[model samples]
Target chain A: MIHPLAVSHDFGVWVGALLTLMVFSFLYRDNPFYKFAEHVFVGVSAAYWMVIGFWTTLWPRVIVPLIPEASRIVSSDTPLPERDLSAVVPAVLGLMMLSRLVPRLSGLARWPTAFVLGTTAGYAVVRYVRSDFMHQIQATIGDGVLIPAAGGGWNVAESLAALVTLSGTIFGLIYFMNTRRGGTVTTPAARIGLLVLMVTFGASFGSAVMARISLLVGRLQELLGDWLGLL
Target chain B: MKRPTPQILLTGVALILVVAAFMAPPGDGSSGGFAGAVTYADRHFSSWFGILAVFAFLLGGASLLRTHGRRVRERKADWHYSAVTLVSFLAVLIVGFLKLGGPPGLTGDPTDASSWLTTIFDSVLSPLHATLYSLLAFYVASASYRAFRARSLETSVLLGAALIVLLGRIPVGVTLFRFDSLSLWLLKVPNTAGQRALMIGVALGVVALAVRMVLGLERGRGGDGS
Candidate 1:
């Protein structure tokens, strides 16, 4: 007996490492392996999401509501929840969203589309105004450019930083507001604003790059340390 | 003008929500009549959105099958890829739904201890996603190298800021230069300032768009143009 293909051999570790290699093969140039992996990724990921949605959402909200008996699947000993007829509204709307497949009733799809859009827009406006506009401004400069010291005196360094923050914010707004394209409508505020915005975007992108670097490091660690048994 | 059902619904739904926003100032659970009703409606609408998302996923699955199935049947270029996609999709979907290898039960757990779907996810999906995302490191580095040429004052500031931020994240920068605090200051002060400005602008734009949608001025969004 070969001891079931050796005690140390693990199936999943090998498959994961190979899949990682297949995807990385694109760095060498596009090829069949990369394409195959890409397709598999797409298919598997979509199916995985669907599975999650079924388990997390549809199974509970739709199935359990429609067939209260389905709740027993969650646990054999738990009480069955009350049957709710309201679940049918969402069910119908959901089907309506997919009516685009048919030629004649394709227009029926608009109902759900409109419903989602309306609700989202309404929801978003309130959130954006409250959080983004009102709260952000209040935190940024609503108390004036005075960073009060713990003992009630002005902390010069903190106050300077606060002033810079206020000025940068106002100038950045100036740049965005002054969207005219020409030879030179560039006000001093806009010029300063442009610099601030660039710095901001650069810092943001740098954070993203660092994130990717961490992921790369992690993937490499997995390949070398876990799969190859080398740290 | 011809088809009006979706338009009417869009107007009505948006009006209700916007009206609720004005009339039912949040934390008004104590205020008994209309405000309470509006709050309840708002909660229901959010729930409805979530419920629709689940169905939308199923719809997306159907769309994927139709698109790929056609390509495979028509013997389109690289139809084998489509075949692979279809096989993988069906295998995962079926195995997950059937709860294959799970404890003799109807619980729809895709990651059941002995499940094939879980095996596929652990061995296949996780690595693929991590590897794909990690590939961005090369792309981002190369793109930054090209873009950070410092042709003007703005680009120079961008280049400097990026380098400072990047160096701040590395052990050498922290050890030799004490660049970490400088980078943190840059992120905290100026970054916050710019982001807040942008957020305010975006909030205003959203309010405008929302109002347009409510008034049915944004009819093009409804694909039927109703």
Candidate 2:
């Protein structure tokens, strides 16, 4: 009595439930179903990204403007006049990206790839040097120096904590410096630096965990509101 | 050492194009000038590339099938898992591509919740992804308890700062101690300072790595270095 499509929908819902449960089963133990879901997840996500990149990045940025009607008019305020052949360079570069699929032509893709890498690297370097290095140094020096409170007598705890943090930051940086020599794992200074690094990593892990839990809570709220209508 | 013929040629061509695009004298015409011509070429190229990438999804799908199919055919012990994977994959693919249970006519109405693809993806895949990600909470708590220890003076200071910040972030901390001032101090001063220092180090490392990559000094290309 039921329509064929209705049966298909029901079947799909059941399959989806099974997959969801299978993945969740991982909390209890590793199993075949979890692996299957994981692989499928990877495959689907990769395909989704490639599709999105083409539609969002390539199509809009490169393709649409090529149409005569879509071309922008150049005026006194405009930076550059329109050009037909300008698209050719990017087009060739995009085609070069596909060259990786073919063993022989894969090398051809490197030119476009290198340009992208080089530009990104250059931008990152300048941004990092200004924002990360200079800014951090200025901040570390300017603040966190303990001064006497209105009541008088040194704010011992605050002053000591600040000193320790400043020291830890310096030691951590030194630990990472590849050029430095004589600071081996066994040395007292090296051991202290390593300990600081470990604590920093631990704190990062804790924060990351909190972030994930927050995301989970958000998703749960959506499910409750939409599916259960419990809002 | 084969002379880098392809690399040199590609780089040269890219440089010439970039320079020409930038330096060519401007013209008065709206769409007939050198700029317009270049723009046209770029757009058409982009559309073709987009189309190529879209079709390439089939290549990916085929590769997935082949890999999984081989395992199933070989009758691997866990081949049943492979079977489930292929079935689920094909089911999603068919539902999406065929637009199964889509609107009666061919208007391409994605809003139709009745569509099997929408129903399956919305009800199933979305929640599954979220659930998997949520499992990290337990692991994180266990890791933190074990790792956050105060064995020395420096460590005690680190732990103390972390505890203050942690309590500050939660509503319970604010309600219990009314120590908003202490919490804010921990975050604004120590947390920010530490984060900034780490960022600087990371930035320096990134710049050095990037320079190496550009000059071909860092050949990240596959396989163990010979």
Candidate 3:
């Protein structure tokens, strides 16, 4: 920590400190300062992303491929499009996406939209089935009811703990799938499942708190150490 | 689904993809065969999808400009804020696109360390974004306060687990409560079980949704009512 009198005179650091304070002002309530900061953030972040997207995706995937001559401006090192004609497909679809800007031709955008959603649905169906459904179920209950002991014999206590876990997993599954139906599956197991879910959510909240607190601490450290020179 | 052409396209594309993904011999399809062709198609589709996704940023920028421009023109509420937004947006775009204060060319990296865009991002955008996320810390605390006020068995369980986990993480709390072991057990056993169950359930939902989309019975997000 340095003295407040010794705070750095850098213009960027000052700007950062002021923006930090402006955002923190939201904690007091809505105000013009907060609003201004929020708007600036929105605009700047959006433009930052657009500039990034143009440089990364558009310039390489579409521009360089479609117009090989344009590569001179993109940088000397950018590989001349490996797959030449294939770039035309996405380029056309992307242009079709912008057709929505015109009121009459807005329906033309649906073709690209359909492609995006269709491809996503295709991947999602296969991915979730293999990863989330089959793999998760296997991980949850793959352990046999009779547990192996560290020594030589079957361990009763460990087996019972395994049983508890297996039962909790089943109960939780039942709760999620059969809650709205309100049938025989909504037995005492569902209540247990509810408790398990609650515990899970609480643990998740605690984890999220840790993450946010770390960020908060980092910002505070920056303000104190870098800006105010009073760490 | 209600629209015939898009619905068919959606169904057909999804069906072909699902079939190719499942049936095409796995392992990145590197060797020369039908499998390689299928894998190549799938990979190209994904790359195209990424390119298509970037176009959404264009739509976002256009939407922002239109909304803010309309508000400023009509002098609506908070019009000055809209004006500020437009100025900042255009300023960043212009400076970055022009490659200001760096290599002067269309291909020059606008976000290079030496560029003015990098300067604005470092001092302005970065702080605002991080501080925005930091606000969530305060929000989480306030939310937990309200939630804990609910006197019930469930809240009791939630509070108990949260307290243990929170205490287990910090140095002083761990020394005082010895909650580290219990927290580990809670996370490893019960949390894992619950998460697995949730995952399975959500997977089932996703599959169902996918099936609906593939069958043209549903067009939820990109449907746009048509």
Candidate 4:
């Protein structure tokens, strides 16, 4: 059967199909076409991200706030007429980061780097404490182990599940204990922890595989449905 | 001493920012007082960071150009591929900047969907990224096959869990033995419990590291203990 792509002259689809094939060629062997495609991919991706960074982030956030009039020029959704002096501080700090590209002035970059590090560290502490620590502990503690049955008594399966989960969590924590000497409590808990960790890793691996397969399916759909029109 | 001064100042700024975050008024957008000033400062600093992060992309681009340029200049093996890399980089950059095939105006957005930039991105970069990511499917299949060998008790448990998860997620397993329910139980209960433990530990570690950085006990940027 003649493919629809043979008749229709969609240049964009053709280009996409060819590039997708070029990338897939790596599965057979590392050829020049694959290398060419790989490098182009890297270059274009870097450029694309930079374009997004400038247009979406840097231009509006740093420039427009300081210059305010740039809002009109850049087609900013919200036009602030008054200049914000506060915006100038980050611009200066950002310029300080760029100074590292210069020879003698490289020391200036540390200020921005330090600022970034500090802010990130500060930000992470708040987020991690609230979400990862407090929320997780709260969930663990508040996990309804004993579900009320239809008649009146607690559900045995749910209670067992709760016990297992509590045991798994405790054992997982015990596994990370560095100073624990081999003992009745520590050894058994450590063993259970290892088993729990192994199960977790396996589940993670399975999920990762599923995700990759979905991507593969997507590419196949593009090739067959879009390019070949076989689907 | 010179290096330490900047480091110290940056640390101080971080601490102040953190403290300000806590002290800032809950939802006062009017810019009334100290809360307003703190909010203003916070935003400016954040924007500066965003701008600098964008500039880092330039450094990355420069590095790419330098690598390929050197290869082209030296006439190294497969130097033609280097040429391809450099040419594509320049082509995309110039095309995007000029807004070639964009709307007929100087004010046209360079990255407008209708522009050549988006066309190249859609046809080339998107496919390339998708294909590259999809290649992991082949690698993962092969790797999982190799890794799932039940060499010992620990390995057996791992293999069992992996197989259960893999099969249970698919339609056939769901229809055959209600493995989906079993998988869900494993994932929601034991898996979540294990993950929570790990996350709590990681959070504590992060808090410690952040405190160290704020105290200026940890080295800032170069990590040379400055």
* Residue A34 displacement (Å), model 4: 0.9
lDDT by residue for model 1 (B75-114), tens = 9999999999999999889877877765664554666767
What is the C-alpha lDDT profile of model 3 across B114-141, one tens digit per residue? 7888999999998888899999999989
Q: Write down the TM-score of every candidate.
A: 0.92, 0.63, 0.91, 0.89
lDDT of 3 by residue, A32-83 (tens): 9989999999899888888888888987888878888788775777566554
Model 1's CAPRI class?
medium
TM-score of chain B of each: 0.87, 0.65, 0.86, 0.85
By summed lDDT, which 10 consecutive residues of candidate 2 chain B come out lowest?
B217-226
Q: Which sequence of candidate numbers ranks them by lDDT, best first? A: 1, 3, 4, 2
C-alpha RMSD of each candidate structure in angstroms: 3.7, 8.8, 3.0, 3.3
Error of 3 at B210 (Å): 0.9
Tens-digit lDDT track for model 1 on A1-231? 422322226788888888899999999999999999999999999998898888878888888998899788776788989998878888899888788777799777778888888788778888998998999889877778887889989988888888888988888889887758662436888888888888898898889989999989988988877787766
- Kindly report which residue pairs in candidate 3 clash with one another: none
Residue-by-residue lDDT tens digits, candidate 2, A1-231: 632332223454455556566676787899877887776665454444443454445544556445443322211333433445545656666667666666798676555555454444444555676778877787666666685666998788667767766776776666566324654454465556665665554455546666778866756565444333455
Which candidate leads in DockQ?
1
* Selected candidate, larger lDDT, 3 vs 4: 3
* 1 or 3, greater by lDDT: 1
Worst 10 residues of 1 chain B by lDDT: B217-226
Alpha-carbon deviation at B2 in model 1, angstroms: 2.4
Report the C-alpha lDDT of model 4 over B1-226, residue by residue, as the tens digit. 4357766766666666676668866553357676776665555556566677887876677778888899999999989888888888888887765567877643677778898888988899888888999899898888877877888777888778777887889998889878998898888878887898788889999989887777767764443223
Q: Which ten residues in a row have the lowest lDDT in candidate 2 chain A?
A: A69-78
- The CA lDDT at B188 in model 2 is 49
Query: Residue A150, candidate 1: how far off, in angstroms?
Result: 2.3
True contacts kept of each: 0.73, 0.21, 0.74, 0.64
